[model samples]
Target: MSEETAARRQRPRTLRQRLQHFMRVRFWRMDIAADAWIAPTASLDRNWPRGIHVGENCVIDEWAIVLSHDYTRGLYRDTVIGPRSVIGTRAIVMPGVRIGADCRVEPGTVVSRDLVDGEHVAGHPARKVGSS
Candidate 1:
């Protein structure tokens, strides 16, 4: 067998070994606060903090991208997802956005600001569409 091939085979399994590899790779740096649930298929981007502070019982769905830094300007910030909140599939949470407890961010939503507790938001620039 070729030396290069043997070396490749001996390499450690990257955190991103699954179909949704980005999720696991990014999650390695996340804090993932107590009892928070993160789906295996979720795709968390690298423009996030070294650790994610997820409150208890938070459910981050598949393909959700939670960011803690603004890549455009090279500014870093922290993202806080409060307890019991649900982040829907493919939702994008921008840097420094604080999602309050029990909030619901719908699929395909782009959240760029703070969300109050129990708020139900949707759309590109997510707004308070209703109260949960």
Candidate 2:
């Protein structure tokens, strides 16, 4: 990482900011980049929060859901949202899914599998619609 970027990351989180991300970053042990934006209404899998990773500059919009576990199958797997990606409003990302860097997941879409870098996906099972 660039020196400036590293320094920015090292900067302390303000009380308000800490409170906003407390559930995922502190109590849940999720790996969310300092610059990532997770909307207040977004839902993350509390069952396996440690398995969820949100990369730098990623945005998880309102009502988006990112899962790291499936209680029905008793599975706990890592789910990754790569750098600069955007999880659109109300989207659902299934367990163990890895969304690559710079990708875009459209609103209300359900992602059940991995995505390559720069892909733009939409629909129930997240079909590729475009790419960056």
- Backbone clashes in candidate 2 total 0
lDDT of 1: 0.73
Compose the digit string of candidate 2's lDDT tens values, residues 1-132: 334334444556556556878767878788999788776788888888799999998878789999998989999999999998888899999999999998989999999999999999999988999887
Q: What tens digits encode model 1's per-residue C-alpha lDDT throughout 1-132?
A: 224323433444334444333443355666665355566666555555463567776777778988877668987888889987888889998878899988989889999989999999999999788876
Question: What is each predicted model's overall lDDT from 0 to 1?
Answer: 0.73, 0.85
- Identify the candidate with maximal TM-score: 2
Residue 26: error of model 1 in Å?
Answer: 12
